[model samples]
Target: MPVTQSDIALAHHLADAAGAVIRGYFRQPAGLEIKEDRSPVTLADREAEAAMRRLIEAERSGDGIVGEEYGTKDGVTNRRWVLDPIDGTHSFTAGRAIFGTLIALVEDGWPVLGVIDQPVQRERWIGVAGRPTTFNGTPVRTRACPQLEGAVMATTSPHYFGEDAALRYLALTAATSGGHNRMTPIYGGDCYNYGLLASGQIDLVCESGLKLHDFAALVPVAEGAGGRMCDWNGDPLTTDSDGHVLAIGDPARVDDVLEALHRVHD
Candidate 1:
């Protein structure tokens, strides 16, 4: 079934709830701890997700849940609410404003509604399938780029890519590093990159090792803004996607970006 107006309102409510919990802990000794993967987590991350989950259960008891801090919760319907309470816990604990809350509603393994909420910045991006993306209630569109060359691109970090994948990422940097702009990849983006792309701030974002909760919301947000989101190999993002993701503001630049991503290097 399609997402309803009620679904959209609930999504905003979820963001609001998570944002409130996150604000309480932001930069105030958030009780940070290291997870098994060597990544940091904080009191805000756990509490924010818990807050959203509660709201979801209260409003839509039939919907499933996929979360970062907590694990999955199965439901009776095909719809699932995916949550990443804080996209950049490391940055959040450091008092940086780049981190944001990510929420996506996946129906039948495909995302139909997405919300990227930055409570600290008071910026909210909403994207629903078959609708234009909006930033703080105003519709937004992706900016056009002539080609991949010199296009500004971003990723959270290089470490997300493995040994072999790092080389492929390097190839993309080299491809877009030419021309007068002579640009390299911006080092930190996380969920903010896709929002910026939707609002016409950047041209591309490519990364690997993402989870369903990581890239699920991004697809609708980017695609609704006249962009395209897919795997590095140009496949559509599904629950079954391999975690390699590429977001291009200009659909025309996709072939060039994919070619660069696959371009072999010595």
Candidate 2:
């Protein structure tokens, strides 16, 4: 089924609710704790996710929900909203404004709509399948970089990658750099990197170990902004993806990026 304008409006509402809760905890995350996986969680993460869930339950009853802090709530319909209240807790708790609230509406295993909202910066990017992405009410487009040669790349952190994957990433950067390109590499941004790519500030992003909420909202945003998003295998993103992701500003460059990931390392 196609994503309705009403659904888009509700997505904004969800982001609004989540952002409201997160903004209150800026610079003062309460009840911070390390999860069993060793990732940090905070009161802002929990409360913001809760707030978004409440709205989904109210406005879009019967829609499923998957959240980072609270886990899953099954629904009768195929559509589910994947929510990550604050994507970068380290940045959030440390008083950085790069953290964001991610909301994705996945219908029949495909993301039909996505929103990345940075409450502190008051920047919101909305992407609906088959529609252009928007940032702060203005349409955004990715910069054209057809090959890895001159592309600017980012990942939240290379530390998030496993040893083998880390080696592959390093090889990819090496391929993009040390040539006439002088390709720039960025270290930290979390979900914000996708937003920046949508707005033409970034060229490519590679990440691993992400869950549904982390990358679901990013797919539509990147694609809607005239880019391509896929797993490292050059396949489209799905609800069950293994979490290895690449977002390239230009569709023509995907093969180059994938080639570097494979050929340079293997």
Local distance difference test scores for all models = 0.91, 0.91
lDDT of 1 by residue, 189-216 (tens): 5999899999999999989999998989
Error in Å for residue 165 of model 2: 0.6
Residue-level lDDT tens digits of model 2 in 1-266: 79998999999998888888888889773678999999999988998899889999998889999999999999999999999999999889888899889999999999989999999899999999999999999999999896677678899998899988888888788877855445658888899999999999989999999989999999999999999999999999999799999999999888888998987545
TM-score of 1: 0.97
TM-score of 2: 0.97
After superposing candidate 2 on the true structure, give the runs of residues whose Cα lies further than 4 Å from its correct spot: 179-184
Worst 10 residues of 2 by lDDT: 175-184
Candidate 1: lDDT of 223? 95
Return the lDDT, model 1, position 29.
Answer: 81
Error of 1 at 42 (Å): 0.6
The C-alpha stretches of model 1 lying farther than 4 A from their native spots are 179-182
